[model samples]
Target: MATLVSILLLLAMWWLTMTTGALAISPGRVVATLTGGGTRIENLVIIDRRLSRLLAGSLIGFCLGTSGALTQTITRNPIATPDILGVSAGAGTFAVLALVRPETTERLLGVSTTVALVPVAILGGLITTGVILTLGWRGGFDGYRLVLVGLGINALALALTSWLLTRAEVEEASVAVRWLVGSLGGVRMGDVVYLAPMVVLAVLVCLRLAGGLGALRLGRDIGQALGVSAGRTEAGALITAVALVSVATAAAGPIAFVAFVAPQVAMRLFGTAGPPPLASGLVGALLLVGADFLAARLPLELPVGIVTSVLGAPVLLYLMTRHLRRTSV
Candidate 1:
């Protein structure tokens, strides 16, 4: 009931802000813009321009949140997330690589923007995620080992990203910066259409693996004892997690903490001793809606990524400190 109420509240807030012009587009006006005009200018701009970006952000948030929970559960690491695992970084790397190669980037745009990002992003995500899995394989990818290796990968990826940024032209760098920050501006319907199927598929995969993931928390030997194939479960969960994060990064850049914030909040709300995938999805949707709403209202026009980082970092720090204290005691 609380989850349902929270979803409804966020929807209401989104609608209210959009309708009141607080979102930079009045509600009635935007709707009319949606339903209005054949061959009209404002109508084209609203439908083609605004609505696509809105949906893209929302959908990506849902996928990322669900994936985050699955990743954390599968790896048995509370801090494990798409961003932390270098999935987004790997995806972003491929994306920037494509953009830097004009001939290839042009060829990519031929199909669709979202499609262009998906293939490379998914490949990159899987590869990077696979590396971490391999690194943590013998020890069964426990929380501490997973996090430490992942942070190392993340650091290396960041350095590579900086190197890539330096190699690119000035105009490309400007574009890359915007992509890195994550935003809903200039998104196209093609992007929405292309990304939607991948997101849905990834979410369903996450749902299917939820039981296995729950069992995984009991530790590998116990999970295997219970008839769970630890190897297969981890692989599937990792694939799903990578796909979700890849699609989101490809579609809307890396929205840093949606994965982290959503699962944590969901677990708290559900009173679950561990991560809840479904609950995390709902929380993710709510967080994105609220962040996007505020992004629309605020003077600096922050991206959803910025909002999550600003708000989530402090909360994450607190959790870490509290956990450390408890463990030490």
Candidate 2:
């Protein structure tokens, strides 16, 4: 029932995106446009422009939310998101680097700019995850150690990103900055085509692994005794998360706390011991779609990331306060 409500809310929000934007198309017009009965202007506005933004926001949020659930569940930490774990930072770094220095990236990586920066971004995220997992697995990928190591690595990745930006041309830097902050603006159908299948498949993978993950929460030994391979499940979840973050970053930049906040909010709403992937994904899609709507309507115009950060910061602080109290007790 909660899941159904969440999905309905996502659809409601997405519907509002079409009907309530700057152009102020009516809901009826939007429906008509979809069914092929609207004006030329309505078709261009709804199909060419707004629909891409809607799909981009929805897809990015869903993937990030699912990734966050997997990461938090695997690490057993509510606050452990791809954003904090250096995956987003790493993916963003490489993607931004490619944007600002496409020639160099192509030269060094033997990748073509014609194909987009997805490969470089995925490579960067995988490399970063490989290092963090290797280090975090020194004895075990415990939540505390993973978060701490992730913080250090995340800082380094951001520093490198900053350096790359400073050396970029003004035009390139302007483009890079917008992408870095996460904008669903200028999304095209081609990008959506690339993103849709992967996001759907990845979320399905996360859902398929849910039973084992739920059991693994009891403890490794218990999970292992129950015929779950702790190592295999953890690896699969983390890898899925990395792929989701990498591809989404390549498509839409690192969109801030959708990954972190979505899962936590879903856990609260559903009363789960750990965040559940599909429900968390629905909430995430709602959050991002809603954030994009707000960003679009705001007086100054803003990247969607700013809205997410503003909304998610308070939650972060509240979680920190709770974490502190629990640890101190």
Candidate 3:
């Protein structure tokens, strides 16, 4: 029922995305256009343009949310998320490098400047995650240590990104800055196609592992008693979360806070003790789509990340305060 509500909300948000832009089309006309019965202008605006942005946002959000669920489950901590894995900072560093100094980045990466950003960003994120995993693994995974180690690496990556921006000309840095803030503005159909398979596979994987994840969250002894291998589930969840976030950061330039906020929100919405990957994904879609919608309409116009951060910060504060109260009790 919670998932159903989330889906309905997501659909409603998508409708708003389609119907409420400049030169507004009615909801019925938008549906007709989507179903292939509208004028050229409507098709151009809806199909060729808006649809791609919406799809990209939805896909990115789903991946981030699912990743967050997996991470939170493994760590048994609401605050643990893909953001703590250094993926965003690493991806942003490489992306900024590509945007601000395409020639140097291309030479270093041995890819055409045109295609270097995504792949380079992916490489950077993966490399950063690998480094974190290496240093933070203490006989078994230590969630707290991992977060701490990842923070240091993430800081370095963000610092590198900042230095690059400062050295580059403003024209070169302008595009980099927007990408860092996480906009769906540049998303096109091809990017959506690139992300769909991974997003679908991630969801399926999450579903398949859901039971094990739930048990593992109860603690190791109980998980083993329930015939779920705690080590295997933890490792699988961690790997999946890392991969999903890396790919998403590469694709969307590190949209802020979705991975941190989605799973916790899902848990509260569903009144569950643990995050449900499916519901988290749905809420994530709603959040990003709604953020993009709001971003488009706002007079001060900002990136989707800016909108997400604005909305999510208060939620994070609430969750933190609640957690503090529980611990105090």
Among these predictions, the greatest lDDT belongs to 2
Q: What is the C-alpha RMSD of each candidate to the true structure, in Å?
A: 2.6, 1.6, 2.2
User: Which window of ten consecutive residues has the lowest lDDT sum in model 2?
Assistant: 108-117
lDDT of 2 at 112: 74
Q: What is candidate 2's CA lDDT for residue 233?
A: 93
**Candidate 3: RMSD over Cα atoms?**
2.2
- Tens-place lDDT digits, model 2, residues 1-329: 88888888888887887887678998888999999999999988899888888887788888899899999988888878999888899988988889998788778878776355888888899999988888887655688788888898999999999999999999889888888888888677878887898787886787789888998888777888999878889888988889888988888788888999999999989998888987887788899999988999899889888999999989889998999999999
Rank order (by lDDT, best first): 2, 3, 1
Q: Give me the runs in candidate 1 sitting further than 4 Å from their true place.
A: 22-46, 104-114
The C-alpha stretches of model 2 lying farther than 4 A from their native spots are 106-114
Comparing 1 with 3 on TM-score, the higher-scoring candidate is 3
The true-versus-predicted C-alpha distance at residue 280 of model 1, in Å, is 1.1
- Expressed as tens digits, the lDDT of each residue in 1-329 for candidate 1 is 87778778767865654454333555566677766632365565456654565577667778788889988887777788988777788888877776655566667467644356677777778888888878866667676787888888888877877888899999878877788887766467877786688767866776787777788888888888998888899878777778888887887887888898899888888888788877787788778767876776687777777887887898779878988998999
Positional deviation of residue 251's Cα in model 3 after best superposition, in angstroms:
2.6
Superposed by TM-score, candidate 1 places the C-alpha of residue 300 at a distance from the truth, in angstroms, of 2.2
Q: How many clashes in each candidate?
A: 1, 0, 0
| Model 2 global lDDT (CA atoms, 0 to 1) | 0.86
RMSD of 1: 2.6
